[model samples]
Target: MTVKTFKQGVFLPHYKKYSEDQPITTIDLPNEVVIPLHQHIGAPCQALVRAGDRVKTGQKIGESAAFVSAAIHASVDGTVTAVEPRPYFTGTNVESVVIEVDPEQKEPVWPEQDLSSLDKDAIKAAIKEAGIVGMGGAAFPTHVKLSASKPIDAVIINACECEPFLTCDHRLLIEATAALVEGARLIRKVVDAPRVYFGVETNKADGIAALKQAIKDDETMEVVMLDVKYPQGSEKQLIKAVMDREVPPGKLPLDVGAIVQNVSTAIAIYEACRYKKPLYERVLTLSGDAAARPGNIRVRVGTPIGHIIEQCGGFKGASGEEARLNKLVGKIIMGGPMTGWAQSRLDIPIVKGTSGILIFSPAMVAKTEHRACVRCGRCVEHCPMFLYPSHIGMYAENGRYDSAVEWGAMDCFECGICVYVCPSNRPIVKFVRETKRHVAAARAAKAK
Candidate 1:
């Protein structure tokens, strides 16, 4: 069978071998956790617990009245040590709730809700209370997705963990197949979608099989095999591949009467509605050449990257020994190499959207200086958004931020294909970032 796929996405090397087959292992609770209040895409949460307050596991510690935000919960029974600004993965300081875990832990109990009797409003309320967001890195509130304005007929469960070197979703599919399938059904019920499409890349044969077997004999859902391509798991591409629907530019999936969701988010929704569990922890990939031990890890929301590395046996060459993955280290990216942010340090805590951490040796880092863009159309040819990346990038680099937007810089999804194939090693994604920042700043100034 020919798998469906979106056009123009690059077929780069799939680097998921390190942890793709490794079963997930749980990390021990860290001594302290620094959970940010602004983990999602919308308004930041306000501190609900003050310093010196004792909190239980799954307790809400940060909350916002804003409809676009989700609550923050304590992952462990602990004492609030501080509610102060701390370093975040995106290179900004965010107000965070720092907790000191209690030496003795207790099994936590949550208020229960009957899933069969809950209405759509009640279900949405439960999702919001669970603090669930798009665990696939977008971090948008899940309840908002369920509250789509359009009447959706199809809901896509994006199991296409398309980013290179990230395989936590694959592990989830193999290990928790039933949970994921049931979760998809729960999601469909919430949105009243007629059918659910579980989209998986053809590369994940095991995941595809597991999902197929799990959804067998079920008429509400079907397993869709997608092509092997980078960014195929992206919401826009996933929708196109599974439903043959093109979301018009400047629109969303709801515009096409469809809603795309990360497989992890569905599982979280299931846990919340069934067991009344809050999303204080998540499963993420801890792979790459840099770590001494690379595997999938189930980590709490506020655990620091430094502790994660220590549990994984530290960086490739921590003991003054030259390990293969760490000869002249160049950059430590916090997510996948293609779209992840370069981390200045490892003190940042894991957030809901963190999918994987990557370490690149100097050999892998681009050493060539950013040069003038040649008229080559590689960026345009490879762009998934069909925008002139080079033109918008040049406009941004030249400080013509408005012109960059005029050239469709806003349309760029920062997939890094332009930067990947550029012969001159131009930082097209960086320009896109800058262009967006400037455009936002301009909007704010005008509003003020």
Candidate 2:
């Protein structure tokens, strides 16, 4: 009966009704896919297969020698058309492998592996080889995360899809409950943890119920209901809410005897360990007011956003006309509204970190130019990280990167809560990003 929660977060409209009841549907393989080599936080992968090479589904197409990088696999049986720079969801050009999907494609048959016999190292190796990353959008290589130096006491499964209009994780809980449970156990074993916790929000009653029923007989796992709050699914906040462990300002969950993985990430880990299947595809919610048909879809990682939009019934205007013709579609976001990137064009392809593709009509999109910080202090009161975003924004705006750093710019995860609550409509997340770039560049220069 005790619903656990973290401190300092904003309450917002769920906006999940559009796709929460919809079942997970698989989209047809896109004709061509642009698989970016740099989808994670670390070093980008080098193209393993050059143009004109034939690749099968689940084949490793890109890899890197860096310990922080995860491999990139071909999501479909296809012929590589090019290995060149392409537009990415981040509004930048990244080297990508473009593949033309073969028409006569068949389901990939992965050799079943004996999951019971795999040890901790074997499990970690399998995860890394499969190219599995944090499917909740952080895109941190999962294997690197499981390599905890500190002893871990528990593993928390983040089922709190707290971002507005995202129901893919909730659907995964209902449809892939068994896989999620198995994946949690695998993660716990890797960290040598004794227990697993599922941190879910109260809004997802069905998902919570399904998880509870699935873990009823398991003593090592339990479901922890979390309050429905924005940014509740963030790594540090989830750890705090579920395990009541505060990860230090510059530390990770493992530092506090816990490891947190998203719901979709857990499912990917299970598939990789049990079937030796690579993480080439994932489930994401396609929903917004402008989307003609909104639903949760299982899609390949490299599918183009344009192709996905057309296949998902295209865009619709307010009066039921084509949105493009009316210029009614204002924004296309690559992830959740809170932390997702605002896309300029639809030519970019979805990557491993993409959690959703949201299309919003002009009427639903707010058009406002960010003004100077009003010093109203709402951003400070509501920030889940409890940092002075106003000061950080002001410092970054004035090109004072060191001052921004002192104001905790590096510690910020850019959840956008500060911007959401800002009365002056100041773009705090943008300032934080700019500050981080400058600080990182300065550090590199100093090291040189």
Candidate 3:
């Protein structure tokens, strides 16, 4: 049987060998953690703890009045050090609660319940209290996803970690297969879905096998192997790959009678529903050419990037700005190379959505300047949404955001495919992002 995939996607280096087989390692508890209040897609959370206050692990320290937002919890039992604006992975400073860990640590314990007896509202309340969000970089509130108004018929577990140099999902599937399947079932129950599908890429053979063995006895669940291609893990693409459903433009997965959740996110749901564990920590990949040791590690939310690198053995080769040649040209990405944000500082705290921390040396960094598009149409050919990226990019660059909007800039997900394949080194994704921001501002102004 042929594996299913969405059209117009690209194939790139998997870059998984460095840490694919490395079992998940736990980072030593840091003295301080900077928990950002706005980790999810919706409204920012309000701090519940002030300086000098004490907090416990898994305690809710931040919450919002908004229904779309997820709560924030403490990862360590510590005293509140401060609550201030701090740098986050998205290149912006967010209001964060800083905690100084106590000298003596106490093992964090949560409520353990019989999941079979819980109703849908109870499960959703547990998940919302746990601060569960999409761990695959979207950071959308999982409780909101579970409470969709539309009737769902199928749920797709996006196990296709197609991004290069990232294997946290693969490692999780191998290590926590039972939990993931249980989490998927929990989601099915919440949405009242009849069928569940694990859409895994062909490259993740071990993950697929492990999940199959775990769910083989379940009649409603099926494991579907997807094409080993880029963007195959995207929600729309995964829905198409597994269920042959195409979500119409300007719509959502709920519109097509389907819902998708990340593999790690599913594990989180299981942990939350069964053990009443809040999402205070998550598994992430730390790798790249500059990394001294490449591996997957479970880390506390709000831990500094610099601390994580030190525990992983720091950078490869030399140290300091003088010895590091890439200091001028290289970048440290907060996620996969294709869609990750380039970071200028190492002090930012990790969030629930952070999947990988990839480092690039000067040699590995792409060297290119802004140049005119050759109009080879490579961007259009590789675009999963089939939009004219060149036109949007040019219009955005020329400050003609209206034209860019007309060219369907808002439809672009900034997958970085056009930028990756551009011969002229055009920062197409960046331009599209700027245009979208402008369009959004215009819409907001008009609405007022």
Q: For each candidate, C-alpha RMSD in Å?
A: 1.9, 1.5, 1.5
Deviating ranges (above 4 Å) for candidate 3: 320-329, 446-448
* Best of the candidates, TM-score: 2
What local lDDT score does residue 176 receive in model 1, on the 0 to 100 scale?
A: 89
Give the candidates in order of lDDT, highest first: 2, 3, 1
Each model's backbone clash number = 0, 0, 0
The lDDT of model 3 is 0.91
Candidate 3 lDDT over residue span 100-178, tens digit each: 9887879887668899998899999989999999999999999998889999999999999989999999999999999
Tens-place lDDT digits, model 1, residues 45-105: 9999999999998999989999999999998899999999999998889999999999998
Hey, what RMSD does candidate 1 come out at? Answer: 1.9
The list of candidate 2 runs beyond 4 A from truth reads 317-322
Error of 2 at 304 (Å): 0.5
By TM-score, the better pick of 1 and 3 is 3
lDDT of 2 by residue, 50-167 (tens): 9999999999999999999999999999999999999888778999999999998989887888889999999999999999999889999999999988999999999999999999
Q: Relative to the true structure, how large is the alpha-carbon lDDT of every model?
A: 0.87, 0.91, 0.91
Give me the displacement of residue 418 in model 1, in angstroms. Answer: 0.7
